[model samples]
Structure formats: C-alpha cells, structure tokens
Target: MQTIDMTEFQSIDLRIGTIVRAEDFAKTKKPAYKIWVDLGDLGIKKSSAQITFHYRPEELIGKQVLCVCNFAPKQIADFMSEVLVTGFSDIEGHIVLATGDKPIPNGAKLH
Candidate 1:
C-alpha cells in the first residue's frame, strides 16, 4: 500500500455534491451517463460516468454524491466532463455511487 502526507491527501479536492441531472451518453463507446452535479457555491459541474449498469437517469436526480472537483475537464466523445463522479465497482462490476450517509450541504469538502 502507499502512504501519503496529510497535506498531499488534502490537496485532492474531494467534495460532496448533488446530482442535478443525468442522461444517457449515447456517443461514448461504453454505456455511460452524462450527469450534472450542483456543488452549491461551486455551481454545477458535468461528468461522464460509466455507471449505466446500476443506475437510471430519472433516479439520479437530486441524489447527493461525492466528486473529485479539482480534476481538469476531460473530453469524452462529444461531452466535456468537468468533474469526476466518484464511486466503487460492485462485485458484478457495476458501479455503486459514493455518497454521504446523510444529507449534507452541497460543495462541502471532505475532511
């Protein structure tokens, strides 16, 4: 395993945000979703996530989730993803979103 100093770890701008919208990303090679997250004061950011196996667009709305806010925007197919919607792969290889256990204000930094 690798270890890092607290300062280094803190630099990873992980934050909590809410899913403001989600839709099928039909242009990507893999099945994915184009999602918009409302990060409170940070505003909304976009991401393309390969999470179609376990989630539906309608269900994702208003769901609170964790995100890597500092990553540079990436272009996937025609979509320009602005943030990374963090999650884990399930036993079946489907994604399970990373989310706060309880409701928290959007854009709250993870400590």
Candidate 2:
C-alpha cells in the first residue's frame, strides 16, 4: 500500500473546525452542499461536499469536523472551495464526516 512518511503526513494541515453554515449546492451537477466552517484564528473557510445522502444543512451547523486547511483553493461550479471537510464513506456509500467525539476548540491542530 502507498504510505507517506511523518513529514509528508505532517505537511497536511488538518485541523478541527465547526460548521458555521451549510446549504444545498444547486449549481453543481451532483448533489452536494456548500459548507462554511469556522476555523478560529484562521477564520471561516468554505467547501463543497457530496455528503447529502446522510447529512442535512441544519443538522451540520455547530458540528465540529476535521479539515485539510492548506490545500489550494478549488472552484467547483460557482463556489470557491477553500478547505477540505474530511470524512469517510459509509456502508451504503454515503459520507460520514471525520469529527472528534468531544467538542474541541476551533483551529486546533490534529496531531
């Protein structure tokens, strides 16, 4: 299997962020959501997530989730995705977000 060294893994800026906002992504070809996460000192960053199967906008608010903070901005349709909201797929192929069990401060680095 392909594996990255500690340095390479550390290079990925993964942090905890709270979902401040979420909504349906109507302009996209596939079903998705436009999510804005509050990353504390880093401020709020937006992302496009194909996680509609298991998540809804109202339910996502205040939810603390993991994020990849340093990726280059990507434009999906009309949205400029600023961060990657990390998650794993479920048994039925729906996304289950990567989140901490306990509420943690925003922008906390994931070690």
TM-score of each: 0.97, 0.97
**For each candidate, C-alpha RMSD in Å?**
0.7, 0.6
lDDT of 2 at 108: 100
Error of 1 at 52 (Å): 0.5
**Candidate 1 lDDT, tens digit per residue, 1-111?**
999999999999999999999999999998999999999999999999999988999999999999999999999999999999999989998899999999999999999
Clash statistics: count for each candidate? 0, 0
lDDT per residue as tens, model 2, 21-86: 999999999899999999999999999999999899999999999999999999999899999999
Q: After superposition, how far is residue 60 of candidate 1 from its true place, in Å?
A: 0.2
Question: CA lDDT, every prediction?
Answer: 0.95, 0.97
Poorly placed runs, candidate 1 (over 4 Å): none
Among the numbered candidates, top lDDT falls to 2
